[model samples]
Target: MITRYDSNNRYSKAVVAGGFVFLAGLTAEDCSLGIEEQTASVLKQIDDYLERAGSSKEKMVSVNIWLTSMSYAGGMNKVWESWVAPGIVPARATVESKLATPDTLIEIMVQAII
Candidate 1:
């Protein structure tokens, strides 16, 4: 069975199935925000989704991160490292790409098992 949460006209923020959750790419609502603030917002969204899906960021198995500006990677990584679990950090891949939202600097999507 599949279940979706926090859906809107554009996308369902997260979906769960077979005891796992797949979260949509998360970006800050206010694109004008700097990388640090944007990263904070993204992490908060991830936290909320994981909680609703019976999991947590610490339980994330993998994450796909995209930064519109490659130069911002270092900044984003700093925030990511702070949120990632110390001993059980998830596998992650970070890449540079143009985001759908012009001002968005970063986007993160995650997969986790409850």
Candidate 2:
């Protein structure tokens, strides 16, 4: 069975299926922030979503991060390293991509055990 939460017309923010929770790519609400702040905001959203899905960052199995520019990666990583579940780092990938908005610096998608 599949369960979804935080839905809008476009998509559900998170879905639970096959013993896993899948989170849609999320961006900071305040896009004017720099990479570090944006990254932190997105990660905080991930934590909330995971908890509502009966999971946590430590249960995350994979993460995909997109940045508007690779130059922002270092700043992004610094916040990620501090926020992520220690010793339970999930499989992750970071890449430079054009985001949906000019002010959006980063977007993050994650999958975790439920």
Per-residue alpha-carbon lDDT of model 1 for 1-70, expressed as tens digits?
Answer: 9999989998899999999999999999788999988998999999999999999988999999999988
Q: What is the Å distance of residue 32 in model 2 from its true position?
A: 0.7
Which residue pairs clash within candidate 2?
none
Give each model's whole-structure lDDT.
Answer: 0.92, 0.95
Off by over 4 Å in 2: none
Which candidate's lDDT is highest? 2
Model 2 lDDT per residue over 6-100, tens place:
89999999999999999999999899999999999999999999999999999999999999999998999899989886899999999999999
